[model samples]
Target: MRANLKLKFEKPLVLPIHYNHIIQAAILKLLSDENYSRFIHDQGFKYEKRHFKMFTFSRLEGNFLIDKGNKTITYFDGASLQISTIEEEFMKYIINNVLLNEGIKLIGNHIQVEKVELKHMDVEEGGGRITTKSPIVVYSTFEIEGRKKTYYYNPKEKEFEEILRKNLIKKYMAYFGKEPKDKYFKITPIENLKESIVIYKGTVIKGWNGIFEVNGSPEILKLAYDVGLGAKNSQGFGCFEFI
Candidate 1:
């Protein structure tokens, strides 16, 4: 069983926000130039898709703790929908209508309070080296409502998981100021393919005769293929050198 990964935060009551406002904030933040680009790239890496189609939505309802001795100002809760497809505009429509709005009947219904704040929680799962499960599971807690989420792709899973993970990170970073740093996520293939399990986007590799293979790794080979490293063959690339 996967362990439950969670985080929590608290704020004093000063102001209240209607559910619609939170949705708008999320949409505004996600569509921003920086956030969108990051979201796109991350999706690209995860889905291995030339283009990324994404959509998400949430519905929230909670109470703010109002007490001089206690500090709980705002509450947030919502569900999410993510999809990847070749049709770009179709995906955008879903995000704009369903995911962004969560079908909120009234934008004005947002309850305003004295104070405002946001809290966040995240669950993460990682898989590598079946024999070694030391870090297969990682749990991180956050103090703010905003936080980033990252997902590592397993070749065995459906094609879209990676893309979703990357975009999720972009979404979180846009909300939070910091991004999580994990050595596992940074994994790029090592010089020798036999020993390496994964490769990164911009890895540098040496081809045959110690020359940089112009075409890069071959795409057909099961073990090693074209990424940042370039093309390759199954057994060996004719005694090529590696970085």
Candidate 2:
């Protein structure tokens, strides 16, 4: 399930250029249930040593101006953000909390929820084209010179596809509590592939945005659509829409 939130503020919405953490915090703040909030925020669904939040969200969508000097973006009118998740409980909490609250305080700015749209998609036997709502991230960490270093992969790299497939399988296991009958999955860029660099908190992260041909098992494909692709999904990466 997906929830698209249309928001309006009395004044222009201004935020730092790297505002992913801020948006994340705002969403977590909406959870009225304390235990549920801590579970998703601190722990999440566990599989092996990994924790899967099973949700992803898009960047704010609207017309905006960038102040290079200030390193901030200001949206003139309003903005919308789409949140996707496979967990029905989490979806219910977000929708209910947002509707019940009079307004949302995002980064010290008061914004009203103008509208909320719910959507769902069916992935057929054959996969379809998908365009990213947020860039997909794939990376590896290694010990170099007695220090840990992170390397981000380009979409064209073979490792990119391999890691993505493996990641999805793990997510499937985490959610379904069983292995998928079919493990087949592949994603290839079709057009307009672009590299994106994002700063979350203070860490530099790399990702890719593009229209891609996603072919895979229907169940796994649907899971990818629901929870996003690649990595760092909860931190606003790998949200896509079927094209």
Candidate 3:
């Protein structure tokens, strides 16, 4: 099972808000469901400068809400509202205005979100049986420091590729606030290159993804190509290279 908290904020405040606070609030609310609901009904929060009256609730996906005045019902995954918090009747006011707009109050706040997950293992007899099955194949390129290396694997390929992609995305998102997309499908091979060097060869394809060290003296980078050729082409094979 996976758990996550989401929040909705009033527009036009600070240029950038660290959505962490909204996540924290949702976590505390979920942990203290009954008590938190009672608190909101009783000692609600108020703001003077900005009359942002916000009420949050939690709901599962695929829920429905009905508007009594309009005699309309709507299904929604999320919702948000704006109102004044000065008076004790703010909730009533919001209901009279926004909720009356054929909107049903969504459970929990809706905005930037964070996830907290829980997992458990299934235990069963004969669950660990092994079979002789062909492994998945993956072709990956990696870079360390300034050196570059490429690998081809059948089974363990995903392990290395995931690690490398995770590190790269983490570093990139930390600085750029977004993740990088795959570039393999977009690459055009540079064939019959005159200036080229063979880095590694004869590597046994084991898993979908794997990491391999470049043979010979390590200079700037090492790369591996999936040489697609018949067993007859082993000696003096027609080579195809990727740039």
Give the per-residue lDDT digits (tens) of candidate 2, residues 1-243: 899999987789889998999888887887778999899999987789889898999989998999999999998788999999998888887888888885577878778999999998788866988999999999999998999989999988899999999999999998889999999999998999999999998999999999999999998899999999989999999999997
Candidate 3: tens digits of C-alpha lDDT, residues 112-211: 3222222212222211211111112334568989898765433333453343333323333432345434311111112221211111134333221112
User: How much is the lDDT of residue 156 in candidate 1?
Assistant: 30
Model 2 poorest 10 in a row by lDDT: 101-110
Model 2 TM-score is 0.96
Q: Is candidate 2 or candidate 3 better by lDDT?
A: 2
- Better TM-score candidate (1, 3): 1
* Candidate 1 residue runs with Cα over 4 Å from true position: 1-22, 25-58, 62-106, 118-157, 166-243
Query: TM-score for each prediction?
Result: 0.19, 0.96, 0.16
Q: Please give the CA lDDT of all the candidate structures.
A: 0.26, 0.90, 0.26
Q: What lDDT does model 2 reach?
A: 0.90
Q: Best lDDT goes to which candidate? A: 2
